[model samples]
Target: MGHVMQVYLGDKAQLEGVIGSKDEALLSRLLDAAATEDAVDPKIFRAIIDGGPFDEDDADEYTAAMYSICSILGGQSIDSVVFHFRSCPDIADIFYDWAFEDLLPPPEGSGCAIWTKENNAEELAERTADTGTDVNDGGEGDEVDDEIHWMNESLLAGKDLIFFWGV
Candidate 1:
């Protein structure tokens, strides 16, 4: 078998298979925090957003909804979704914007990026590697290289790329 890159390209139904349903208790707590005008505790927020239930059909749409809900409950502007979520390092892992820097912009809160041969996926991967932020780097450079190679092969074969993170 060959190395595989962690990318997702599908509607909400497919994402549901990836992340699954939200826990009722977590939702209730988030709602309560909003009702009381209290900041959402980071731990609770992570639990809900990271692996929490997702009943929606479009991952992009659902994630945006989540950001809105979390932001409102936290009394922060929706525009601060990235900053607010990034404060939690684990949540930061959910955004793959770096991978799509010059490619098609991933929808905000959708957590998806597109890549194509025309956009130079190979060059982008190389640039990412050179910058030491290839998204596959969890202290494993060789593995990341292999993933880049896999992406190159896929793109060369005329397969475009759509990646999802943060779920």
Candidate 2:
């Protein structure tokens, strides 16, 4: 059988399905190119954006489109893609559920672990503490308030990137 090529936006909803080895190679190459540079080429980006069939009610299609864009822009693949815009605390819990409930299996590894933000934050926080949260906490010689403000601003500016993947 010939190679089958499926294009998905962000969710698994298929945008275009083509049959040909060459087409499959081209698509894979495009994805690789986008993933490498942390940016998608305008031509490829426009192609994906314009190629989908119009379906206003299709949430899956829109989600898939976002994923396609992310994939093109170096986003990794997880079983499900959960988007958290504008930084909410619940975002971490959402990711936790995705990992433990959807992706991770029991100790025997019966199921796959999905990606979520909870796990990421927990890990990040732990690492931050381990690496020394003291840098943010003012020492006796430095101004504590200024240090706190600077840390807060830095964290706010360092927003998490919108994509992740598990191999």
Candidate No. with top TM-score: 1
Q: On residues 103-157, what C-alpha lDDT tens digit does candidate 2 reach at each position?
A: 1121221112222234334554665566544445435544433223333333434
* Deviation from native of the Cα of residue 75 in model 1, angstroms: 38
lDDT of 1 by residue, 1-167 (tens): 12112343222222232232355555665567555765334443443345643323343444433433433333111112223453455334535453323222234444544445455476656767686555445546545443354455445455544444443
lDDT of 2 at 158: 41
lDDT of 1: 0.42
> What total of clashing residue pairs does each candidate reach?
6, 15
How far out, in Å, is residue 77 in model 1? 34
Per-residue lDDT, model 1, residue 44, is 37
lDDT of 1 at 14: 26
lDDT of 2 at 24: 49
RMSD of 2: 14.8
